[model samples]
Target: MFINMASPERPVSNGKRDMEIDKYGFTGGDQYTFPGVPGELPAETVRKRETKWLVMLDNWNIWMAKRFPQLKKRCRKGIPSSLRGRAWQLLCGSRPLEAQSNQSFQDLVSSTIPETATEDIEKDLHRQFPFHEMFCQRGGAGQQDLRDVLHAYVAYNPKDGYCQGQAPVAAVLLMHMPAKDAFWCMTAILTYYISGYYSQGLEVIQVDGLIMQSLLRKVCPLAHKHMEKLNISPMLYCTEWFMCIFARTLPWPSVLRLWDMFFCEGVKVLFRCGLVLLRASLGNVASLPIIPDTYETMEKLRKLDKNDMHPEFLMHAIITLRITENDLENEHRLQMKITKKKGNSSVKLVKRVYRYAPTLQHHGIVQKTGATKHLSSVSVDSSQVAKQTQATLPQKDKLHNDAVTLTVYRPISQSSITTLSSSHTSNQQSEGPNKDFQLKNDVDQAKGTYL
Candidate 1:
């Protein structure tokens, strides 16, 4: 499946016969090239890393449970390319989610989805990584798989449906694995990692822009002042960077390297990268020459210097940044408070969307009665209810003594919660505050670890 860059019959031309492609399948063109584009790792180093990754993959549960920090460290270094797809699935806990689902990828793809979603997905197919061999052809296998993955996702989460930004993200996943696995990995990403970014109002991303601005003010005051003076919003420069997960923003090598850390470390990596880019472009006095005007500044942000963006240098800079998960969370809370004070309706919607945390139970994927439908619920560990809620009964009426209640159960091996059928029995009450606290902790842990 490798691109043959040295083939003589396929002349190196700017036309359709262009044979020059990079190891990552980037076409030979100035647009894809950058100064100091990193070279491939040495054979021995790659081999050693791959071997270590194989061992880690073999004992994934143990590593995730007891040696998570060590695993995070290795992920920051970089994942071996050959094992990256599997590593991503394991890292995000997508495999178990995929396995526990009642619906198969085929079923999802075949089921009915919105026509608008399908049309939007179709339009974006050829646009994503079109220069790469995998998706170069208009109606090729790559495009077809991209279609299925997007279609299935639309079917799976119809509320958010499809966004143009997701095409590039899914296309990148397809480059690493099959459509099914890519779908689940994308599911984990959209459901947990960057949940609200693509929703209708895009409230979360808007709040994040403010958070990034706040971080910039602390970390790089000069850049912050410069942007403020120019009347430039963070969203003006960073929307594509955050929305596409940098797929279209960074060079190919740096994009992959960033994703390696991003999937493991969660969305903080994005904030760090954004801060670094701001600092690199405008923090110093010398940067004035490159960005003398608003237009030039926007251009500079879009097309960063190749040497600065080299995978090794970019990753080093990202690692050195002082931002942390707690920083992001704290800043997010501050932004939300400010937004709430302003009476922004979107903030209320964001709060509601995040309250339940978008687990399997929130999606109604698992049922109480243990009945299954196409892409429906699976009953696992029938004895343990993960969540329960009961309506208060009116004391005056004996007929209204039976309270309506809802119960959700947890799977034995995975972290998702499932819902139970409503019961009108008088004794069907919530599991009390202690059990509710424990269930919330479990859901929080699942969200935190996966992200």
Candidate 2:
């Protein structure tokens, strides 16, 4: 049993699993056992990444069909390791950023040399998915390179500054690209698909969420309810996901899959992906032993596997959602309805204000619109002032100016003229009232003049 020194027929260890290889190469012990060691960053994962990346590439539509005849098959199966960077660039529609015509890529990269970037990049440097081995190096090259590129990008787009969610997405990109190319690709992603999800003021992101919610309510009422029930509102989870394009939640390969679709489809694809996730988990969600809470809802949704994520079905659902009966009917019916009600109310209001316009005419105040609306009865000082103006101004002139000024004045508060002439004015002076007028006209007029 211990004759290894002389024996040619000794058993040897196979690479990953601890299976045996006898004199002849054959896996003998538990052929499929996992290794004791945790996984490491593999040497050449580009092919796998490419194949996954292509899943989202989709058929040639208006944007990609003719030029990308080969994109479909090429991305799905895999890409060669060395070629992945170039392939990924083409896939994400960053062809423009990486365009041979990229007049400013180096200019932009050179601009990243500022001292401010060194600190910001350093802050996010180790913070991004540092636990992953590819991101680690004794020399710290992995993290260093990624941070440098993204920091360059933040310097690159001063408008965006640096957001927390962009790092993981940047790391994934760095895996397959040089720093500059990765930075530009990130640019394309934020500019195109991210909408306003990561903006500095975050108002665009707020509007984008409203848009997403409107889209969701139209397409997936059940999933929308689940989110509302758990208060796992889009505001919470989506901030990071949309900001980073699901980089943290999805594996790198899946991230590629999502981006391929995003590049081809647009922001609408994100909502479709949401629907797909919900549909995928609908069964688990429905079958849950208890009414699902927020975490429960997400856990169920998280269980979604791409195994049966039929792209065709998802695409159909997204495109069809726009063609609604209400949306198609007469096109302007809703606008007309709102306009008609507004019009009728204005007529009644003008008549009421005309009755009071004469009384206020001495003050050079006049009511505008089909009916007139003098100052509300509550503010006697303002009403008296209005009356004095109406009296000084000619009758015709006061009405005309009232129409013009009110058109540009405080928004009409009540839908009806009745409320306009009523005692609705509160005496409390409004905050910033003077500032608003200052901004309204670049040229300030004399206090009492009608010019």
Candidate 3:
């Protein structure tokens, strides 16, 4: 007997099914949609760029050392999507950290983390790029990967634990690369580029917000006046923009482009982009009618027109703005001074802990433990150098213990080598057999010689 079984009708209401999905998997016809405009570079241009980028990747250390300006120019143009993951890793100096780390990503992910962080991460997994195919499905690979990366970060950096904003940033990174690479890139960013931003007090971000306001006052006085008149503090609007690194706020193409420059140039790109956004939204007289009050102003900021955010337009705007690193540094110093005068002890501690030095870690001078130490290239006085070398020697072979004075020879130029040799010979002859030690010639062509 055939049963009259009927399948339940699928509910339909919105135009979701008709929405266009872009090549990158973002759904169109809504706020989450990728821009419909042709914002990407031409195919030919992209191929050329990819070739150049591959060459740059091969000589990354050399390019970073000698041809930084050219490298910066290319990065500002945009990294090709295929190579972006590796480019970002190189730009932020994460690849070395990954190699140097004592604990692996798997180790961190398998280890236990705080229940609070785990719960928070679980809650936010589906929310990051929910419209995108990768993360759209519950318990999918994307969501699982996102969960693992965030969980590992909490285990890796217990001090910061996990911030809600980091999920989206990690989600973006995971979209480009594997969870392991994403974790290290996220570590470099959190450790150096925007340290203290996600710490308990959110103090560094607060200082940056103040810096943003000061920048706006100079770059777009009209916008600054409007915001100040309405008493719309930057923290009210910019916290999410800065915190998520604009992963949530900007169009996908613009986000990628901004990040390209950001990794190459450091956090100043963020400030420049923020200034551009503020000027676009609130600086114009025409914008005032649309964004009259704080609520409307915030709405405008949150839901910026995609056309304005298209990479070509947005990047052009960001580039035209003449803000410099010095400007950002000056503003940061000014804001911190004001904060210090206010006697906010907690904020003061934040300043001390997260003092802004964007390049400190990128050059490998700062370690994962948050300690600041000098690299081999840093110069030391002869006395200190002697003391260090003496400390390394065996106690029984210690010159200090024998009451014999030791001379530490500095690296000398090739032209001065002969003079130093002659002086050493004369000293040996004058001091007789007691000074018969042979001089070691270790020539470091770049810096000098060490004996």
Candidate 4:
């Protein structure tokens, strides 16, 4: 029997026949249905873009070198869905890690994870993208692939382990690439693009939130004062937006467009996108009838006008804000300085127990208790680079050391998905601000800078 996973409606049955469902939630029967009207951008225009991207992608090494500025400019417009996997791999510099990491993923997925981590991953599998056909099944291929990605990630970076926001990010990567490639892309995103986001204490994530609040005040002072009046904190809405890279906040197309620029331009895109949302939602946030619940205010962001949520509109709004790359860099430095001072004031404690991967024997899973790992490698920015650093774990309750097993029958859902469009919107499809993407001839020629 086939079930319609996209909607909550009941399944229709034909007692004499077997029902089959396709990925987009359509029945496999050969019935023709009229398509919805095309958006402002026509199909031919999108196809032309897809062709242009594919040509550049086919010659990536040369294209990225000679036309780095061009690639950046086009990526701001958005990547075509068909070319997104390759485009992202190129943008994030994940290709070199693919061969090495694919073997690592294979080795880890076949082995047992810490009983706790395994339970956590299984619980989140269906919840990652329940509405999408790929993950709706109880133990379907999508869930299994999602499980493999999360499990491999924990094994690869046990220090970071599995965090709540990582699931949605992983799920989106899987939608574009093979599981192994997705793993590499996700690794680069965490370590290089947004370091400390998923780390314990989430200090960097909080710091980024402060930076957003600073930007909000400058670009939309009225909204900023209003939020301050009501005690609306950036952590309340901005954490999920940054942690998941806006996956839960914007529509799928908009998310892709933001990602395209994010990979090319780095974390600044996230800040720009966050500021745009705060500015757009100013009235909704300010006019709250009473003290607001965090989720209630967030739901307001989730339900932004379809037009405003469109990637083109959001990007236009983002570019109009007069913040510069230097402005963000200065703010980031200040936030980091404040964060380090705060960290120094607190006592650092280490937990003797490794809660994620120690005991498979007790669960009747025949893995050795003596399984050891070399320190998992991660790439950090040059300034913060160190010869060696141990994972800074937070002080936790002793109860976590106790042995316990769990059975996760139902998949736990993650955050909500936005309905914004980043695809095929001619109005929002123009190149970003000219100055932001302009390439200097000297810098372009400089070694290690172009790539």
Encode model 1's per-residue lDDT on 338-424: one tens digit a residue. 555555664442431211111222133332222111111111111232223123223332223233322221122223333333432
Q: Rate the local accuracy (lDDT) of all candidates.
A: 0.64, 0.43, 0.65, 0.56
Q: Which ten residues in a row have the lowest lDDT in candidate 1?
A: 442-451
Tens-place lDDT per residue, model 4, 171-269, is: 889888889888888886775567667877766655666667766766677767666765665666777788888776676657778888777766767
RMSD from true fold, candidate 4: 17.2
Residue 331 Cα positional deviation in candidate 3, in Å, after optimal superposition: 1.5
* Clashing residue pairs in candidate 4 (N, C-alpha, C atoms within 3 angstroms): 251-420, 253-422, 254-422, 312-428
Q: Report the C-alpha lDDT of model 2 over 1-451, residue by residue, as the tens digit.
A: 0101111112225553223322212232211212232332254565565454455333212113122334433433335445556655554445533443334666665664556646666666665554344453433878767866776676667776776667767877886777777887777666544534455655444334433444344445565655555555445444555666665544444455555545433444565565555544543444544546766655554444544343344444444444221221112232224334445332111100101111111122332332223222111122343444444344444233333221111111111112223212212111122221121121122111000
User: What 10-residue stretch in candidate 2 is worst by lDDT?
Assistant: 349-358
Count the clashes in each prediction: 2, 23, 1, 4
Off by over 4 Å in 1: 1-17, 29-39, 344-349, 352-451
Clash count, predicted structure 3: 1
Q: Which stretches of candidate 2 lie above 4 Å from their native place? A: 1-83, 91-95, 98-120, 282-285, 288-291, 298-451
